[model samples]
Target: MVLDAYASSNPDQVHEDVLQKSRDACYKARDAFYSCLEKESGKKPTEIASVGLLYPKECSLSRTEFVKSCRSSWGPETRGGILEKPYTFSSSSSKFVLLISDVSGGDLFMLEFMHMMTKLRPFVHSFLKEASKMFVLYIYTMGDRPYSRQMAKLLDPKGEYFGERIISRDDGTVRHQKSLDVVLGQEKAVLILDDTENAWPSHKDNLIVIERYHFFASSCKQFDHRFQSLSLLKSDESEPDGALATVLKVLKQTHSLFFEDGGEDLSGRDVRSLLKQVRKEILKGCKVVFSRVFPTKSQAEDHPLWRVAEGLGATCATEVDESVTHVVAVDVGTEKVRWAIREKKFVVHRGWIDAASYLWKKQPEENFGLEQLKKQGTDEKSDDVNI
Candidate 1:
């Protein structure tokens, strides 16, 4: 049997959907494995045991399509049960085992920290199939909460696999600490699985030492690096080194600069509030400027902050040539608007510029703050903008 680890994006913010997708992926993988086995053994899979997990709201597997699929695959299986509750299995019968987990945010971080072991599934399944005394556990981690009761409803009605539990935030350093301990102790061979980086370490003493296993922790890093690199377009001939181009260039180099998970995107609702604040500041005789990090050209064109500037009756310039280093040329009727990204810093030209045509009215000097004012404020309501 071939044991493997797979990772994919969570569907939107719905925790249930995320769990479902992960489980579906596992089944598909299992089916493929079975088909391969047929080619090798020249016989269909006689028996199988499986465990599936869900994250966030640990809803039990009800009599849903997901649970039904497991039942159909393994055949007239035993009825479902709850997490942390243990059940016994026949070690004499042939068995196949599957495990599922749902991970999010820092809870995921803890899992990644452990050097994960792979190939335990096939080994455990084969072992159970050969021995009459077999025990299989399906565990789920609900991120920071304990949703074991809900998850129990999602379990297989058949009693082929036993014991289900939810890993809570306070259970240990990791959300699913007890589950890890049980898997390590009960199963002679074990495989640690997850899609996120930084899975926390649980009871170090209880960890199972599987001599033969594979680790796959580079999953998240590869996706994250690719996301950061291709986020913007500086290759456009019409606006190379322009506002969008410069912003992209800077952001691509700064891997740590990420949109807060769930933070409003710079080009979305947050932009509106920021722009409104800018206008309010300008009206109070203060100069304000806006800048952004765009991972793509389309995003740059649709930036909300830019829209806010237009709504404020402020003249806006975009796709400026590389020779130009200013983002906006503004006028509060006192200090002209001048902003740009230069040498990886926000360069606001302090020189007076004609409000109507972005033409410099006077030379910029170091003491420009003496006559200019800067104000900072935040929106009371958060917007749906994310990086």
Candidate 2:
């Protein structure tokens, strides 16, 4: 929907005049509203933004009425199976959900993937409304090409609703932990999507590490799978479309458990049994991880359920130790953040140079203002340097 303020800031060159005409109507409404208001109200009625024009043209959102327009096609009344029912939101205490994945095959499928997500925006909204925490990450192993650029569009459409929830980067050493550390700072939900088959050196082993982190956090969820398409089927393709469809259905439908339910009450035995069943369902295929993040020391000490988590084949770690190697802190507000590596007893206070570069990659502006500083640091000799 177009608001009566700042709509002219962006207009398609092809339809500039048409959009301007529509915006003119909004301007008139804003003028009328301002005309009736008293100056003492301390508000100016200016032409606001057109939410419809904010979407990419290829998304077919020009005729969009409201943000809700995208979601009007969801729920049981529309079509599909039981999972097809409109999502029933549970109040989320989380501020974000982090989705980290190493998507294979470059960026070809990203647009279509985001289109499908935008289609599901309504359901996402339903989940967010009840969620206390909010944030979702779609991190790719492949670096700064189509994935990073397109993810920015999907996460922050129309240049609003920005937060710590959506972060993407390619630094192998710090990508997983750094992103998770930042997301957990606000105790938000996390959804890690690993589509790249060999994302890490020991991906299967890394999955174990990730599972431990999630289980300990008490505020994380994950979804990982290999990328495949059913539409690729040509006549006599002999690709077993039904089997592929069944697996996709199970992945999409059952993956909701990652977003909705916390899966908290399951004990080690229960988790093992459930895993066994899930394994049986896929004939020993598919790997799933469920975890919880505990934020406070007292919480961990009082409820050592995380200790039990390791028994279920998940690693459980507490990030409280000052001497706990592997802690990397990146804070935009801090002059210098702390960094610690494994077996390192000392915490190094690195200047914001590298950290700032990292942030710039994630938060690029019209003009990057830190180039001179990076050049200076590149010449300096320091162990703290990590740019």
What are the lDDT scores of the predictions, listed in order? 0.31, 0.29
Model 1 lDDT tens row, 1-387? 111212244435455766898999978976786675444333345532223333444455432333344434432233211122133322222221223343211001111112221112222332222221222344445444424433333332333543333334433333334344323222222222233223424422212111111112233254433221110221111233222232223222221122224332212222223323333332132223433322334454476555433433444444443443334322222122222332222233222222111211122433232224243121112222222
Query: Lowest summed-lDDT stretch of 10 residues in model 1?
Result: 104-113
For residues 1-387, what per-residue lDDT tens digits would candidate 2 score against the true structure? 354334644546536766888999978975664553313122232321112212222334322232244345434322111111132212232222334443221111113232211111112322222222333333443444344545544434443333322334532335433333322211112333343323444323212122111111111223321112222221111122322222233233333433335543211112223322332332122111111223323444344333333333333244434423222222212222222223332222122212222121111211222243344343222222221
TM-score, one value per model: 0.21, 0.26
Where does candidate 2 have its weakest 10-residue lDDT segment? 210-219
Could you give me the TM-score of model 2 versus the true structure? 0.26
Task: Report the Cα lDDT for residue 14, model 1.
Answer: 50
Q: How far is candidate 1 from the true structure (C-alpha RMSD, Å)?
A: 24.7
**How many angstroms is residue 248 displaced in model 1 relative to the true structure, after the best TM-score fit?**
39
Candidate with the greatest lDDT versus the true structure: 1
